[model samples]
Target: MSATPSRYCHLIDEGEVFLERCRRILGEIQAAEDDLSAMTTSPRGRLRVGLAFAAGLPLPVISAFMERYPEIQLDLDFTDRMVDVIDEGFDVVIRGSELKDSRLMSRPLGPYRSCLVASPVYLQNRGIPAKPADLLTHSCLHYRWQNSGKLYQWPFKKQQAIQAGESLPVTMVCSNVEALIYLAQAGRGIACVPDFAVKDSLADGRLDKVLTNSLIGGSTFHVVWPSSRQMAPKVRAFVDFAVENFSKGLVS
Candidate 1:
Protein backbone atom coordinates (compact mmCIF):
# COMPACT_ATOMS: atom_id res chain seq x y z
CA MET A 1 0.00 0.00 0.00
CA SER A 2 1.20 3.55 -0.69
CA ALA A 3 2.03 5.68 2.36
CA THR A 4 -0.29 8.68 2.93
CA PRO A 5 1.29 12.16 2.91
CA SER A 6 1.78 13.99 6.31
CA ARG A 7 -0.52 16.87 5.19
CA TYR A 8 -3.38 14.42 4.46
CA CYS A 9 -2.92 12.78 7.90
CA HIS A 10 -3.10 16.22 9.62
CA LEU A 11 -6.23 17.14 7.67
CA ILE A 12 -7.84 13.81 8.57
CA ASP A 13 -7.14 14.36 12.31
CA GLU A 14 -8.52 17.95 12.21
CA GLY A 15 -11.64 16.84 10.35
CA GLU A 16 -12.37 14.12 12.95
CA VAL A 17 -12.02 16.60 15.85
CA PHE A 18 -14.23 19.15 14.07
CA LEU A 19 -16.94 16.53 13.61
CA GLU A 20 -16.74 15.57 17.27
CA ARG A 21 -17.11 19.20 18.37
CA CYS A 22 -20.13 19.58 16.10
CA ARG A 23 -21.73 16.47 17.62
CA ARG A 24 -21.33 17.82 21.19
CA ILE A 25 -22.77 21.23 20.22
CA LEU A 26 -25.75 19.60 18.56
CA GLY A 27 -26.34 17.38 21.60
CA GLU A 28 -26.38 20.44 23.91
CA ILE A 29 -28.81 22.22 21.60
CA GLN A 30 -31.11 19.15 21.60
CA ALA A 31 -31.00 18.98 25.43
CA ALA A 32 -31.91 22.67 25.70
CA GLU A 33 -34.79 22.17 23.28
CA ASP A 34 -36.21 19.10 25.07
CA ASP A 35 -39.85 19.68 26.10
CA LEU A 36 -40.91 19.30 29.77
CA SER A 37 -44.60 19.33 28.74
CA ALA A 38 -44.13 15.71 27.66
CA MET A 39 -43.50 14.83 31.30
CA THR A 40 -46.38 16.90 32.72
CA THR A 41 -48.92 15.62 30.17
CA SER A 42 -48.89 11.89 30.89
CA PRO A 43 -47.29 9.43 33.30
CA ARG A 44 -46.51 5.99 31.83
CA GLY A 45 -43.45 3.74 32.11
CA ARG A 46 -41.64 1.50 34.56
CA LEU A 47 -40.05 3.51 37.40
CA ARG A 48 -37.24 1.70 39.17
CA VAL A 49 -36.82 2.91 42.77
CA GLY A 50 -34.63 1.89 45.68
CA LEU A 51 -34.68 2.70 49.38
CA ALA A 52 -32.79 2.01 52.58
CA PHE A 53 -34.75 -0.57 54.55
CA ALA A 54 -33.20 0.47 57.86
CA ALA A 55 -34.63 3.94 57.30
CA GLY A 56 -38.08 2.31 57.38
CA LEU A 57 -40.22 0.54 54.83
CA PRO A 58 -42.32 2.82 52.60
CA LEU A 59 -44.57 -0.05 51.49
CA PRO A 60 -47.82 1.54 52.67
CA VAL A 61 -47.16 4.77 50.80
CA ILE A 62 -45.91 2.96 47.72
CA SER A 63 -48.97 0.68 47.82
CA ALA A 64 -51.27 3.69 47.90
CA PHE A 65 -49.36 5.15 44.96
CA MET A 66 -49.78 1.97 42.94
CA GLU A 67 -53.52 2.21 43.31
CA ARG A 68 -53.52 5.85 42.26
CA TYR A 69 -51.29 5.51 39.22
CA PRO A 70 -51.84 2.12 37.66
CA GLU A 71 -50.45 3.37 34.38
CA ILE A 72 -46.95 3.75 35.82
CA GLN A 73 -45.29 0.49 36.78
CA LEU A 74 -43.12 0.56 39.92
CA ASP A 75 -40.13 -1.62 40.64
CA LEU A 76 -39.09 -1.41 44.27
CA ASP A 77 -35.72 -2.35 45.72
CA PHE A 78 -35.62 -2.36 49.50
CA THR A 79 -32.01 -2.70 50.61
CA ASP A 80 -29.33 -1.50 52.99
CA ARG A 81 -26.58 -1.32 50.40
CA MET A 82 -26.22 1.85 48.35
CA VAL A 83 -26.99 1.19 44.69
CA ASP A 84 -25.46 3.25 41.87
CA VAL A 85 -28.39 5.18 40.42
CA ILE A 86 -26.93 6.06 37.03
CA ASP A 87 -25.24 2.73 36.34
CA GLU A 88 -28.16 0.72 37.71
CA GLY A 89 -30.77 2.79 35.82
CA PHE A 90 -32.85 3.51 38.94
CA ASP A 91 -35.36 6.33 38.53
CA VAL A 92 -35.25 7.33 42.23
CA VAL A 93 -33.78 6.36 45.59
CA ILE A 94 -34.66 7.14 49.19
CA ARG A 95 -31.43 7.84 51.03
CA GLY A 96 -30.50 9.16 54.45
CA SER A 97 -26.87 9.64 53.58
CA GLU A 98 -25.80 12.99 52.19
CA LEU A 99 -25.74 12.69 48.41
CA LYS A 100 -22.20 12.99 47.04
CA ASP A 101 -23.00 12.47 43.37
CA SER A 102 -23.42 15.91 41.83
CA ARG A 103 -24.99 14.35 38.72
CA LEU A 104 -28.03 13.43 40.75
CA MET A 105 -30.83 15.79 41.81
CA SER A 106 -32.18 15.55 45.35
CA ARG A 107 -35.39 16.61 47.14
CA PRO A 108 -35.34 16.57 50.92
CA LEU A 109 -38.27 14.63 52.35
CA GLY A 110 -37.59 15.33 56.05
CA PRO A 111 -35.19 14.61 58.86
CA TYR A 112 -34.93 11.30 60.72
CA ARG A 113 -35.10 10.98 64.52
CA SER A 114 -33.23 8.66 66.88
CA CYS A 115 -34.65 7.23 70.07
CA LEU A 116 -33.12 5.36 73.00
CA VAL A 117 -35.09 2.26 73.91
CA ALA A 118 -34.76 -0.89 75.96
CA SER A 119 -37.02 -3.83 76.64
CA PRO A 120 -39.29 -3.76 79.69
CA VAL A 121 -37.53 -6.86 81.01
CA TYR A 122 -34.05 -5.40 80.51
CA LEU A 123 -34.91 -2.14 82.25
CA GLN A 124 -36.42 -4.01 85.17
CA ASN A 125 -33.25 -5.99 85.81
CA ARG A 126 -30.67 -3.33 84.89
CA GLY A 127 -32.61 -0.41 86.37
CA ILE A 128 -33.68 2.69 84.45
CA PRO A 129 -31.42 5.67 83.82
CA ALA A 130 -32.33 9.24 84.78
CA LYS A 131 -30.14 10.91 82.21
CA PRO A 132 -27.92 10.36 79.16
CA ALA A 133 -24.83 10.05 81.35
CA ASP A 134 -26.33 7.00 83.08
CA LEU A 135 -26.41 5.17 79.73
CA LEU A 136 -22.61 4.78 79.81
CA THR A 137 -22.97 2.24 82.64
CA HIS A 138 -25.61 0.13 80.86
CA SER A 139 -25.22 -2.50 78.17
CA CYS A 140 -26.11 -1.08 74.75
CA LEU A 141 -26.78 -2.47 71.28
CA HIS A 142 -25.30 -0.64 68.29
CA TYR A 143 -25.80 -0.30 64.56
CA ARG A 144 -22.39 -0.67 62.90
CA TRP A 145 -22.16 1.50 59.82
CA GLN A 146 -21.36 -0.59 56.73
CA ASN A 147 -19.20 2.08 55.14
CA SER A 148 -17.35 3.24 58.26
CA GLY A 149 -16.76 -0.03 60.17
CA LYS A 150 -17.64 2.09 63.23
CA LEU A 151 -20.85 2.05 65.19
CA TYR A 152 -23.19 4.82 64.08
CA GLN A 153 -22.88 7.94 66.17
CA TRP A 154 -25.46 8.64 68.88
CA PRO A 155 -26.39 12.23 69.68
CA PHE A 156 -27.89 13.69 72.80
CA LYS A 157 -28.80 16.93 74.58
CA LYS A 158 -27.34 16.57 78.02
CA GLN A 159 -26.72 18.64 81.16
CA GLN A 160 -28.55 21.67 79.80
CA ALA A 161 -26.19 21.52 76.80
CA ILE A 162 -25.90 19.72 73.46
CA GLN A 163 -23.52 16.79 73.38
CA ALA A 164 -23.56 14.96 70.03
CA GLY A 165 -21.61 11.88 68.96
CA GLU A 166 -21.41 10.58 72.50
CA SER A 167 -20.00 7.07 72.52
CA LEU A 168 -21.07 4.36 74.93
CA PRO A 169 -20.20 0.71 75.56
CA VAL A 170 -22.12 -1.89 73.56
CA THR A 171 -22.74 -5.59 74.05
CA MET A 172 -23.60 -6.33 70.41
CA VAL A 173 -23.03 -4.57 67.08
CA CYS A 174 -25.02 -5.22 63.89
CA SER A 175 -26.63 -3.29 61.03
CA ASN A 176 -30.07 -4.89 61.02
CA VAL A 177 -32.76 -2.82 62.81
CA GLU A 178 -35.01 -5.81 63.56
CA ALA A 179 -32.19 -7.83 65.07
CA LEU A 180 -31.00 -4.89 67.14
CA ILE A 181 -34.50 -4.30 68.52
CA TYR A 182 -34.89 -8.06 69.10
CA LEU A 183 -31.77 -8.05 71.23
CA ALA A 184 -33.14 -5.18 73.26
CA GLN A 185 -36.45 -7.00 73.64
CA ALA A 186 -34.68 -10.14 74.80
CA GLY A 187 -33.23 -8.18 77.75
CA ARG A 188 -29.77 -7.99 76.21
CA GLY A 189 -29.07 -4.25 76.18
CA ILE A 190 -30.27 -0.73 75.57
CA ALA A 191 -30.56 0.11 71.86
CA CYS A 192 -30.37 3.46 70.15
CA VAL A 193 -32.68 3.17 67.16
CA PRO A 194 -34.81 5.13 64.79
CA ASP A 195 -38.33 5.81 66.07
CA PHE A 196 -39.90 4.18 63.03
CA ALA A 197 -38.00 0.94 63.61
CA VAL A 198 -39.56 0.24 66.98
CA LYS A 199 -43.13 1.49 66.56
CA ASP A 200 -44.46 -2.06 66.96
CA SER A 201 -42.25 -2.70 69.99
CA LEU A 202 -43.45 0.51 71.65
CA ALA A 203 -47.08 -0.49 70.99
CA ASP A 204 -46.74 -4.14 72.10
CA GLY A 205 -45.06 -3.30 75.40
CA ARG A 206 -41.85 -5.00 74.34
CA LEU A 207 -39.67 -1.91 74.43
CA ASP A 208 -39.89 1.34 76.36
CA LYS A 209 -38.57 4.71 75.23
CA VAL A 210 -35.80 6.03 77.42
CA LEU A 211 -34.40 9.56 77.69
CA THR A 212 -37.19 10.99 75.56
CA ASN A 213 -35.87 14.47 76.26
CA SER A 214 -32.31 13.43 75.37
CA LEU A 215 -33.07 13.26 71.66
CA ILE A 216 -30.54 12.39 68.97
CA GLY A 217 -30.28 14.22 65.67
CA GLY A 218 -30.30 12.16 62.48
CA SER A 219 -29.72 12.47 58.74
CA THR A 220 -32.34 13.92 56.43
CA PHE A 221 -34.18 11.59 54.08
CA HIS A 222 -33.87 12.54 50.42
CA VAL A 223 -35.39 11.44 47.14
CA VAL A 224 -32.61 11.56 44.57
CA TRP A 225 -32.34 10.73 40.89
CA PRO A 226 -30.08 11.29 37.92
CA SER A 227 -30.67 14.83 36.69
CA SER A 228 -31.62 15.15 33.06
CA ARG A 229 -32.81 17.89 30.71
CA GLN A 230 -36.39 16.60 30.58
CA MET A 231 -37.69 14.85 33.70
CA ALA A 232 -39.63 11.64 33.12
CA PRO A 233 -43.30 11.78 34.14
CA LYS A 234 -43.04 8.85 36.53
CA VAL A 235 -40.01 10.32 38.30
CA ARG A 236 -41.69 13.71 38.64
CA ALA A 237 -44.86 12.10 39.94
CA PHE A 238 -43.07 10.18 42.66
CA VAL A 239 -41.08 13.26 43.73
CA ASP A 240 -44.24 15.32 43.94
CA PHE A 241 -46.05 12.54 45.81
CA ALA A 242 -43.25 12.17 48.34
CA VAL A 243 -43.00 15.92 48.95
CA GLU A 244 -46.78 16.31 49.34
CA ASN A 245 -47.15 13.37 51.71
CA PHE A 246 -44.16 14.37 53.80
CA SER A 247 -45.41 17.94 53.98
CA LYS A 248 -48.77 16.69 55.24
CA GLY A 249 -47.07 14.81 58.12
CA LEU A 250 -47.26 11.35 56.57
CA VAL A 251 -43.76 10.36 57.65
CA SER A 252 -41.78 11.91 60.47
Candidate 2:
Protein backbone atom coordinates (compact mmCIF):
# COMPACT_ATOMS: atom_id res chain seq x y z
CA MET A 1 0.00 0.00 0.00
CA SER A 2 2.81 2.40 0.85
CA ALA A 3 4.47 1.73 -2.54
CA THR A 4 1.21 2.70 -4.41
CA PRO A 5 0.62 6.04 -2.63
CA SER A 6 2.41 8.14 -5.33
CA ARG A 7 0.37 6.59 -8.19
CA TYR A 8 -2.91 7.10 -6.32
CA CYS A 9 -2.05 10.76 -5.61
CA HIS A 10 -1.21 11.37 -9.30
CA LEU A 11 -4.59 9.98 -10.44
CA ILE A 12 -6.53 12.14 -7.91
CA ASP A 13 -4.77 15.29 -9.15
CA GLU A 14 -5.62 14.50 -12.83
CA GLY A 15 -9.27 13.83 -11.99
CA GLU A 16 -9.53 17.21 -10.20
CA VAL A 17 -7.98 18.99 -13.22
CA PHE A 18 -10.42 17.30 -15.60
CA LEU A 19 -13.44 18.43 -13.52
CA GLU A 20 -12.17 22.01 -13.46
CA ARG A 21 -11.93 22.01 -17.28
CA CYS A 22 -15.42 20.54 -17.60
CA ARG A 23 -16.88 23.27 -15.35
CA ARG A 24 -15.23 26.05 -17.36
CA ILE A 25 -16.56 24.68 -20.62
CA LEU A 26 -20.08 24.35 -19.21
CA GLY A 27 -19.98 27.92 -17.91
CA GLU A 28 -18.94 29.22 -21.32
CA ILE A 29 -21.70 27.21 -23.02
CA GLN A 30 -24.33 28.52 -20.61
CA ALA A 31 -23.21 32.12 -21.13
CA ALA A 32 -23.32 31.67 -24.88
CA GLU A 33 -26.85 30.20 -24.70
CA ASP A 34 -28.12 33.13 -22.61
CA ASP A 35 -26.69 35.64 -25.08
CA LEU A 36 -28.34 33.86 -27.98
CA SER A 37 -31.74 33.87 -26.27
CA ALA A 38 -31.44 37.58 -25.53
CA MET A 39 -30.85 38.26 -29.23
CA THR A 40 -33.90 36.26 -30.32
CA THR A 41 -36.46 37.63 -27.84
CA SER A 42 -38.82 40.34 -29.08
CA PRO A 43 -39.18 43.63 -27.25
CA ARG A 44 -42.40 44.85 -25.74
CA GLY A 45 -44.42 47.43 -27.74
CA ARG A 46 -47.27 49.88 -27.23
CA LEU A 47 -50.62 49.70 -29.05
CA ARG A 48 -53.18 52.47 -29.42
CA VAL A 49 -56.76 51.78 -30.44
CA GLY A 50 -59.58 54.15 -31.37
CA LEU A 51 -63.25 53.47 -30.84
CA ALA A 52 -66.54 55.16 -31.50
CA PHE A 53 -68.91 55.85 -28.62
CA ALA A 54 -71.25 53.23 -30.00
CA ALA A 55 -68.43 50.70 -29.93
CA GLY A 56 -67.97 51.22 -26.19
CA LEU A 57 -70.78 48.77 -25.59
CA PRO A 58 -68.18 46.04 -25.92
CA LEU A 59 -65.86 47.24 -23.16
CA PRO A 60 -65.96 43.83 -21.49
CA VAL A 61 -64.21 42.22 -24.44
CA ILE A 62 -61.57 44.91 -24.37
CA SER A 63 -61.13 44.45 -20.65
CA ALA A 64 -60.63 40.71 -21.07
CA PHE A 65 -57.88 41.38 -23.58
CA MET A 66 -56.22 43.70 -21.12
CA GLU A 67 -56.22 40.96 -18.51
CA ARG A 68 -54.66 38.45 -20.89
CA TYR A 69 -51.83 40.67 -22.13
CA PRO A 70 -50.47 42.74 -19.30
CA GLU A 71 -47.15 43.26 -21.02
CA ILE A 72 -48.61 45.30 -23.88
CA GLN A 73 -49.75 48.85 -23.14
CA LEU A 74 -53.21 49.87 -24.37
CA ASP A 75 -54.46 53.34 -25.19
CA LEU A 76 -58.09 53.94 -26.15
CA ASP A 77 -59.59 57.08 -27.66
CA PHE A 78 -63.38 57.22 -27.91
CA THR A 79 -64.90 59.47 -30.55
CA ASP A 80 -67.25 59.44 -33.51
CA ARG A 81 -64.81 60.98 -35.94
CA MET A 82 -63.03 58.54 -38.23
CA VAL A 83 -59.39 58.82 -37.24
CA ASP A 84 -56.50 58.39 -39.65
CA VAL A 85 -54.75 55.44 -38.00
CA ILE A 86 -51.56 55.72 -40.06
CA ASP A 87 -51.07 59.45 -39.77
CA GLU A 88 -52.02 59.56 -36.10
CA GLY A 89 -50.02 56.48 -35.07
CA PHE A 90 -52.97 54.45 -33.88
CA ASP A 91 -52.58 50.69 -34.22
CA VAL A 92 -56.26 49.84 -34.47
CA VAL A 93 -59.72 51.38 -34.84
CA ILE A 94 -63.02 49.78 -33.84
CA ARG A 95 -65.74 51.44 -35.89
CA GLY A 96 -69.51 51.18 -35.45
CA SER A 97 -70.48 50.99 -39.10
CA GLU A 98 -69.27 49.10 -42.13
CA LEU A 99 -65.78 50.19 -43.17
CA LYS A 100 -65.32 51.41 -46.77
CA ASP A 101 -61.73 52.66 -46.81
CA SER A 102 -59.42 51.01 -49.32
CA ARG A 103 -56.28 51.89 -47.37
CA LEU A 104 -57.04 49.71 -44.35
CA MET A 105 -57.73 46.06 -43.63
CA SER A 106 -61.06 45.61 -41.86
CA ARG A 107 -63.06 42.69 -40.44
CA PRO A 108 -66.72 42.85 -39.61
CA LEU A 109 -67.45 41.79 -36.03
CA GLY A 110 -71.25 42.07 -35.78
CA PRO A 111 -74.32 44.12 -36.61
CA TYR A 112 -76.53 46.41 -34.50
CA ARG A 113 -79.95 47.81 -35.27
CA SER A 114 -81.15 51.36 -34.67
CA CYS A 115 -84.56 52.53 -33.47
CA LEU A 116 -86.25 55.91 -33.62
CA VAL A 117 -87.13 56.80 -30.06
CA ALA A 118 -88.78 59.58 -28.07
CA SER A 119 -89.54 60.00 -24.43
CA PRO A 120 -93.09 59.19 -23.47
CA VAL A 121 -93.36 62.72 -22.19
CA TYR A 122 -92.39 63.99 -25.62
CA LEU A 123 -94.79 61.63 -27.34
CA GLN A 124 -97.56 62.75 -25.03
CA ASN A 125 -96.62 66.39 -25.38
CA ARG A 126 -96.05 66.55 -29.16
CA GLY A 127 -97.66 63.38 -30.60
CA ILE A 128 -95.78 60.49 -32.32
CA PRO A 129 -94.77 60.67 -35.96
CA ALA A 130 -97.03 58.17 -37.79
CA LYS A 131 -94.63 57.70 -40.68
CA PRO A 132 -91.34 58.93 -42.08
CA ALA A 133 -93.22 61.79 -43.77
CA ASP A 134 -94.74 62.71 -40.43
CA LEU A 135 -91.22 63.39 -39.04
CA LEU A 136 -91.27 66.61 -41.04
CA THR A 137 -93.78 68.03 -38.61
CA HIS A 138 -91.90 67.09 -35.41
CA SER A 139 -88.75 68.44 -33.84
CA CYS A 140 -85.77 66.23 -34.77
CA LEU A 141 -82.41 65.70 -33.11
CA HIS A 142 -79.60 65.83 -35.70
CA TYR A 143 -75.95 64.93 -35.09
CA ARG A 144 -73.56 67.10 -37.07
CA TRP A 145 -69.97 65.94 -36.79
CA GLN A 146 -67.70 68.82 -35.92
CA ASN A 147 -64.62 67.62 -37.73
CA SER A 148 -66.12 65.60 -40.58
CA GLY A 149 -68.21 68.62 -41.67
CA LYS A 150 -71.08 66.27 -42.44
CA LEU A 151 -74.51 65.81 -40.96
CA TYR A 152 -75.38 62.36 -39.65
CA GLN A 153 -78.63 61.74 -41.43
CA TRP A 154 -81.46 59.83 -39.81
CA PRO A 155 -81.60 56.53 -41.68
CA PHE A 156 -84.78 54.66 -42.55
CA LYS A 157 -85.71 51.88 -44.92
CA LYS A 158 -87.65 53.70 -47.59
CA GLN A 159 -90.46 52.09 -49.51
CA GLN A 160 -89.77 51.27 -53.17
CA ALA A 161 -92.19 54.06 -54.08
CA ILE A 162 -90.20 56.85 -52.42
CA GLN A 163 -86.66 55.46 -52.57
CA ALA A 164 -86.12 56.91 -56.02
CA GLY A 165 -87.37 60.44 -55.51
CA GLU A 166 -87.65 61.59 -51.88
CA SER A 167 -85.42 62.17 -48.90
CA LEU A 168 -86.37 62.64 -45.24
CA PRO A 169 -86.74 66.19 -43.96
CA VAL A 170 -84.73 67.61 -41.01
CA THR A 171 -85.97 70.27 -38.59
CA MET A 172 -83.23 70.79 -35.98
CA VAL A 173 -79.61 69.77 -35.61
CA CYS A 174 -77.17 68.92 -32.80
CA SER A 175 -73.52 67.81 -32.75
CA ASN A 176 -73.37 64.80 -30.40
CA VAL A 177 -75.33 61.54 -29.91
CA GLU A 178 -75.41 61.73 -26.10
CA ALA A 179 -76.67 65.31 -26.17
CA LEU A 180 -79.31 64.38 -28.71
CA ILE A 181 -80.50 61.56 -26.44
CA TYR A 182 -80.47 63.93 -23.48
CA LEU A 183 -82.61 66.44 -25.37
CA ALA A 184 -85.04 63.68 -26.28
CA GLN A 185 -85.18 62.52 -22.67
CA ALA A 186 -85.90 66.10 -21.69
CA GLY A 187 -88.90 66.00 -24.02
CA ARG A 188 -87.28 68.39 -26.50
CA GLY A 189 -87.53 66.21 -29.63
CA ILE A 190 -87.24 62.77 -31.24
CA ALA A 191 -83.94 60.93 -31.60
CA CYS A 192 -82.75 58.01 -33.69
CA VAL A 193 -80.43 56.17 -31.31
CA PRO A 194 -78.98 52.68 -31.14
CA ASP A 195 -80.97 50.07 -29.25
CA PHE A 196 -78.14 49.43 -26.79
CA ALA A 197 -78.19 53.02 -25.55
CA VAL A 198 -81.91 53.07 -24.94
CA LYS A 199 -82.69 49.48 -23.99
CA ASP A 200 -82.86 50.16 -20.26
CA SER A 201 -84.79 53.32 -20.88
CA LEU A 202 -87.24 51.48 -23.11
CA ALA A 203 -87.56 48.66 -20.57
CA ASP A 204 -88.10 51.11 -17.71
CA GLY A 205 -90.76 53.04 -19.68
CA ARG A 206 -88.54 56.09 -20.02
CA LEU A 207 -88.38 55.95 -23.82
CA ASP A 208 -90.70 54.70 -26.57
CA LYS A 209 -89.83 53.74 -30.14
CA VAL A 210 -91.62 55.22 -33.11
CA LEU A 211 -92.17 54.16 -36.75
CA THR A 212 -91.38 50.49 -36.01
CA ASN A 213 -92.25 49.63 -39.60
CA SER A 214 -89.54 51.99 -40.84
CA LEU A 215 -86.77 50.87 -38.49
CA ILE A 216 -83.24 51.58 -39.64
CA GLY A 217 -81.23 48.59 -40.76
CA GLY A 218 -78.34 47.44 -38.58
CA SER A 219 -74.80 48.81 -38.77
CA THR A 220 -71.89 46.38 -38.84
CA PHE A 221 -69.14 47.13 -36.39
CA HIS A 222 -65.64 46.43 -37.68
CA VAL A 223 -62.06 46.11 -36.49
CA VAL A 224 -59.66 48.00 -38.73
CA TRP A 225 -55.93 48.29 -39.01
CA PRO A 226 -53.54 49.73 -41.57
CA SER A 227 -52.79 47.23 -44.31
CA SER A 228 -49.06 47.27 -43.70
CA ARG A 229 -46.41 44.90 -42.42
CA GLN A 230 -45.27 47.49 -39.91
CA MET A 231 -48.15 46.46 -37.64
CA ALA A 232 -46.70 45.12 -34.40
CA PRO A 233 -47.53 41.74 -32.84
CA LYS A 234 -49.48 43.24 -29.95
CA VAL A 235 -51.89 45.01 -32.26
CA ARG A 236 -52.56 41.89 -34.28
CA ALA A 237 -53.07 39.83 -31.12
CA PHE A 238 -55.55 42.30 -29.66
CA VAL A 239 -57.51 42.52 -32.90
CA ASP A 240 -57.78 38.73 -33.14
CA PHE A 241 -58.95 38.53 -29.54
CA ALA A 242 -61.61 41.18 -30.13
CA VAL A 243 -63.05 39.54 -33.24
CA GLU A 244 -63.20 36.19 -31.46
CA ASN A 245 -64.77 37.50 -28.27
CA PHE A 246 -67.32 39.65 -30.09
CA SER A 247 -68.32 36.76 -32.34
CA LYS A 248 -68.92 34.63 -29.27
CA GLY A 249 -71.55 37.17 -28.13
CA LEU A 250 -69.35 38.07 -25.19
CA VAL A 251 -69.41 41.73 -26.26
CA SER A 252 -72.03 43.64 -28.23
lDDT digits (tens) for residues 15-117 of candidate 1? 9999999999999877756664645568878999988776345766687778878999999887777789999889999887657898999998877678889
Model 1: runs farther than 4 Å from truth? 1-33, 157-167, 246-252
Candidate 2 lDDT tens digits, 55-173: 24767877898788878888888878878877998888988765677788988887777778899998998888787877767887877876786777667775611354554556567
Q: TM-scores across all candidates?
A: 0.74, 0.70
* TM-score of candidate 2 to 2 decimals: 0.70
Whole-model lDDT per candidate: 0.80, 0.76
Query: Which candidate wins on lDDT?
Result: 1
For residue 88, model 1's alpha carbon misses the true position, in angstroms, by: 3.3
